[model samples]
Target: MRNHTALTTFILLGLTQDPQLQIFLFIFLFTTYILSITGNLTIITLTIVDLHLKTPMYFFLQNFSFLEISFTTACVPRFLYSISTGDRTISYNACAIQLFFTDLFGVTEFFLLAIMSYDRYVAICKPLHYMTIMNNKVCQNMILCCWTASLVVIVPPLCLGLNLEFCDTNIIDHFLCDANPILKISCSDTWLIEQMVIGSAVLTFITTLLCVALSYIYIIRTITRFPSAQQKKKAFSTCSSHVIVVSITYGSCIFIYVKPSAKEDMTINKSVSVLISSISPMLNPFIYTLRNKQVKQAFNDTVKKLVFLLKK
Candidate 1:
């Protein structure tokens, strides 16, 4: 076994090594980070303050927005700093913490999205029983379950990664200490580690995908039963936004994690990973608010109330 005590830090070969490209990246990602934080916070705030948004859907949305904020915060700030200062090194401890929390939040968000889909499914498909089915108690339990599952699923592998000695190259190819990149740098034979990671990933992917798929199946079937053109249109519109968001998030995740490894695949994989991590947060607010008339109105009302209070 390698001497773990000797290694103090690991270098991160972030998105790009080019100085000029770094400047461009700093500008672009900084903007994205700001927007993601702002948009998600706004959604959470509106959901909390608006009486109309007190329903189960918005309740889950509030949690999703909070998770997005945390997910983005875990990596984007460090990435932006690295790009600007040209410091691509993270302490070993910091990297492990980052890796743990990133996976924790990411996995939590995946389950949260599934929960949201279930909320939508209940609301759209079983409107009469929606309130009875997804009451405050149920909502709280679901959120708790999502968070608990994330922590449980992430902790063991993270502990394993932390225990492994890093005696080889200390430089991670990606911006963050993602499991794949971190495993590559370990001096130990990571075959078992690799298998563990793949197993965990496959399990998560299958479970989340199944939940989303089943929710959509029921949603589609429910929507088809609507006889009126207006009812059909409204149902379709409501479900379409959720479907798109779920598809994009789940599709990109599957592609990046499950594909055959290749040299050329790295660029696209990194790009897609960045897109899913960075851009998806911004999309949640837009998707939830823009697609639903009630949410938009509540958001506007909340903003107006804030403005009026400021004026007062």
Candidate 2:
């Protein structure tokens, strides 16, 4: 076992090692990071200030918006810094901290989405009981559970990763120090730790996915029974947005993490992983607001109010 003091830092290779590509990559990612933050923040502000958006669905959307902010902040800023300063190296402690929070936020988001799905399911399937069931207290509890679950899922791997000896290469191929990427560089026997990480990740992912699937199934069944054409149309519009976000986020995550690590195809795999972490956060708010009539009206109203205030 090596002394803890000996292993102090790790180097992140970032998106590319090519100097020429670095400039272009930096410009592209910086623009993306700014847009993502701006878009998500706008959604959060709109959701909070607009009384019309105080419903259960938008309430969850607010939480999702906040999560997206935290999620991207975990990784994107660092990448930008690396691009600007040409310092892609991350300290071992910083890398571990980044990994922990990335996993924590990512997993929390999965559960949050699951809760939102259930909320929608109730709203559509059991309209009469939606308010009673998804009351403020219940919503708070669900949010608390999402945070708590994220903590539990992240702590064990974080502790284990911290203790391991990284006496070998410190260079991480991916832009971030994700569990799998970091584990690859450890000099210690990481088999058990790897298995534990995989098992924990898969368990949470599958369980949350099952909840989302079941809720949507019930929602679809209920939608089919709606007597009014308008009601059916409304349900489809709302549900389709949720389904799109869910499919993209979960689909990308599962594709990246669940498969066997293809060391030979690191470029494609890393790109896909980065796509999920970076792009998905920005997409959530747009998908929900653009697709829902209520949200669109609320947003337009808010914009008008803002413009009027600014003119004054």
Query: What is the lDDT of every predicted structure here?
Result: 0.81, 0.82
Weakest 10 consecutive residues, lDDT, candidate 1?
258-267
Task: Estimate the TM-score of every prediction.
Answer: 0.94, 0.95
User: What is the Å distance of residue 271 in model 2 from its true position?
Assistant: 0.3
Candidate No. with top lDDT: 2
Which segments of candidate 1 are over 4 A away from where they belong?
Answer: 260-265
Off by over 4 Å in 2: 1-5, 260-265
lDDT of 1 by residue, 53-111 (tens): 88988788788889889988997899888877778899878887888888889888789
Candidate 2 lDDT over residue span 165-284, tens digit each: 766577888888887777776777877777777777798889999999999889888888999999899888888888898899888888777755423345777898668767887777
- CA lDDT, candidate 2, residue 140: 92
Q: List pairs with backbone clashes in candidate 1.
A: none
Clashing residue pair totals per candidate (backbone < 3 A): 0, 1
**Cα displacement (Å) at residue 283, model 1:** 2.2
- Tell me the deviation in Å of residue 243 in model 2: 0.7
Give the Cα RMSD of candidate 2: 1.7
- Tell how far residue 177 is off in model 1, in angstroms: 1.0
